[model samples]
Target: MNHDTSSEQYILVTGSGQVLAVSDTAQSLIPHISPLLPDLINGAGEDTVLLNGRTYQIHRHLLKSESGESYGLLISLQQTSAVQSSDPRLGAIALALSDKLEINHVLENVVRFAMDLLNADAGALPIYDPDTDRLLPGHLVNLPVDLIVPVIGQRRGLMWQIVHQGSSILIADYADHPAALPELVQVGVRSLLATPIIYGKTPLGILAMYRLRNEPFSESDRELLQAIARQTAIALQNARLYQRAIRNADERFALYQASIEIGATLDLEQLYQVIYRATTRLVSHQRFVIAIPTENRMVEYVHIVTPTGRQAPQQVPLHCGLAGYVLRFGVSLRLSGAQALPEPAVQLLPEIEGELADGSLLAAPLIVGDRIIGALLVWSNHHDAYTMADLNALELLAATVAVALHNAFRFAQIQSQAITDNLTGLANRRHFLQVLHQEMERNRRYHTPVSIAMIDVDHFKQINDTFGHIAGDYVLREIARRCRQQLRDVDVLARYGGEEFGLILPETTYEQALKATERLRTVLATTPIMIDGRQINPTISIGVASFHPTVYPDPSSLIADADRALYLAKQQGRNRVCGVQELTNDAQP
Candidate 1:
């Protein structure tokens, strides 16, 4: 039962409102202030002692230790104030009413009690809008229901100050507070109290009370209002959290429905569009891009869709962009806002038109067959706007989309295989002819030189006759594999028919073709075929033919020229490349 009378002006407690020791003066003043202790503690602002007809504002200080524990102090003012007659039982009644009410119910009663406690003719309880993150006076207890006051941005008034500063404001005279108007005073709100609704030190909102006459709020009234303000904080916190959860759940359900609709698509492009739409709908975004890897460890942006409903056909390289990093790292990259993005990322997306148009971006990797084949980048126009639920849902959708892409690729591969040689795993005769025609057309158009080589395994039929056809087949397969290993990726190797293979080399001349054919013949001669623990020597005869547009204009004629050279090699004891001249000179009628 002690108080600090050094200065009963401000209460700054850093600990949990505990008193360690008191001085003799504090102990002595304790007796005089004990009766009014509850009210003084509950008051919203500066402490004031009422004596005669004058008013004074007293300061109290409270402080919290570094460990977050709080302690209290009391100070007495040099001046004394007059008493403003009000209900003495109002504090106890407000507490009693709030004890029986839940968060919302208690908030309603608190607003009502605020009117009675402060002797206000009208009062209002503003709902804090979580979306706008502002206090909007939409609910009221006594004031006109249509008096909409927005407590956000520039419109932030007394209510905003209390919530933002986490402190209470007591206006003894409305005229003194710059924001107070004569209308508020005329409406019986001569004095005003704005107490912050706080939960665990964080401010949720403010509970404001007003009086009608040219009077100030009592210390006792402030004490009662503070308790009510704390209770209101709890209520608002619960209501806001409940509202957020409901909204998030509803959005998830919508995404779930859209996912089902999109799941029916077997096409990769369609699936990507579906995922993009669902993601943009559930979470706000301006642009979306998908980058898939091409040959040579390079990634190409195959799809780019904007929320503004525009699609671009140009592809982007994944070497210096955020999307590229996502593809390279195979992890999510969440940028806080556009400011957090790297300079290179901003510069690389310059052609994107509209600021790359988003503040937050989420990039997710698409993994299939133990490899990250691509990545999805989604952009949002708000900072830290995406939630854990949004990320989880996107990851699930990404998994599905990856599977769809894999299926599409497999279908394409199957279609390609329809014209491929299954035995030697090379292009079949039909595919070879089609490819030869295409290569010829390309050579003619570009005026690029090309060389064709027709190779035949020497005594292949004799090997099948001596050994079984299975051994012959094994030899053919091994030779095809060697030819593929020697040729560049651009070179085409095809099984022309039984025991015959043809290679179409682009960007090559006659001399290079002859040297390459000789190497092929030597490789087969040196590398022995191991079958059933038996090493069998294999050799090949090759015929080289160089395409000259004027000489061999047609693909069939070019192939025949190479075939005739191969026949000449066979006549001259196979296992050598017979150039075109060898065939013409050796053919004597």
Candidate 2:
């Protein structure tokens, strides 16, 4: 155990157990064999120890040779203080070593240093998985490599306790501590130390060590682990941030792909599926929903995905649940745990009882400019598992999703708008023409009778001249409503033009079309237009024409036949239904 300082390898040391050593030719030391000097008498080579923080092997040597003739000395020595750095720049360089060094090399050095400091059998640094809330054993020395466990959120094990409480857990004997969960004893752990790796306020789980010897974990041992955990926190946090950024970039690329697919997808089901899959993958959630707000604080779930991964039917009172809270407040709620939630949230958890109580939740308010158009709810099974970084990433995704869905709904609205009469809330002239074309085609294809009716308000221009245009508009809207009320759901009613309205009737003969038109005229005559608290009666003239495939050749023939009947209605009287008879041979003149 005689020490050898003849080689200029050992450099400097501190009272705080920090050592600095150097070798110009190589980066590390390897153990070698030599003699122990006992012949020099006087306790030579008794209790000297050599330690290195990096990968190194210790060697025992002698002070003298030739039959052990000289010394019996065992001088306890380590690196001395003169060569150590007192400059702040040296400290900064030391700090940046972890960034420059490969993680494998850093972890190897850390494990070796930890073992030397604690005199422990083994140690392992577990890298954290934020997605699964688990720790995977890594960078191990003299330990089993496969040990992994959940360390955050809902897992009630020792590692989770250390991480969630943000403190270290030291146990002299795992068998004796009542605080230790049952799983801890089953691992054959005699004594264990679990300390959190914290970088500022963020926790990166724990650096844990186990001893089979039942030796008590000491204050010095805890300090050594604490120092290592601090460094580990810095390294792990850096790695995590780098990984998260990479993941975000990948998610953005996927989002772009999804956007292109969704834009081209006319199938609503496929579009929603793409949305849900992308949402759950990017935001770390299992369930999602789209709820649209309606009148009187009531919100309807336009789309809902159950926790079991099935899509529910639409038009349910979705916002009456947790979704309603977001709509009423117009803000996001990230609930870590439901039992610790507010009263309004508690009130909203009936239908989603087990799901809400056991899951983490993030709701993003869908705002189209200044208005709260809807909301997106993302749910996970672990509480408080998401960070501000994850939330910010998801916020971008929510914007994309909201804009896409809003665009889809708007597209549907535009399709319907193309044919709608805005002022009267009826079908416009173009819609009337389209319907006539479709009806004529259907009749020709099926050889069935189709009816057409043309109705004009009686002296509508005179009425507009008598009353103001506003009153005329009000009268027109009233006539549209009465016409709509008198028709069946399958019937088509539209404002044909300025003073004209038209209807296309499927499976109706000429006689039946005339009867339906007369009823529409009667209804308009009885319906009073209330403008400025004054009531005015309105009348309408009607014309009816019907043809089967055997009679009219095309849509043009149907419109011409209907126009002739309309002329006859004007010839007979203003407010009556008139049907056209076929032109006789004598009437050819």
> What shift in Å separates residue 84 of candidate 1 from its native position after superposition?
23
Task: List TM-score per model, in order.
Answer: 0.44, 0.57
Residue-wise lDDT of candidate 1 within 1-589, one digit each (tens)?
3322333333222233333454443444343333344444545555433212123354665545698765465544433321223445543543344233134665677688677766665556666555446676645665556555564456456777776677777778777677876556445566777677676665556677766666778777677677666545544543444444455556668667765866677666676677677766666777777778777766677778765675654555657577667776787766654566754443446444225434667777889878887787777666555656567666766776677677777776886698788899898888878878887888889988788999898888888987799999988999999889988988889999999998988888888888888888888888899988888888999888888777776888888988999988989999889888676643211
Worst 10 residues of 2 by lDDT: 32-41
TM-score: model 1 vs. ground truth: 0.44
Model 1 residue runs over 4 Å out of place are 1-167, 171-192, 200-203, 208-228, 251-255, 297-299, 342-350, 353-358, 368-370, 381-389, 416-589
lDDT computed for candidate 1:
0.67
TM-score of 2: 0.57
**lDDT tens digits by residue: candidate 2, 112-220:** 6566656776666675566555665657666545445434446666666776788887888878887665544665668887688776676655677777687878876
Which regions of candidate 2 deviate over 4 angstroms?
1-170, 182-191, 198-202, 207-239, 258-281, 284-330, 336-355, 366-375, 380-387, 399-419, 438-452, 457-469, 485-492, 505-550, 563-589
Clash number by candidate, in order: 44, 8
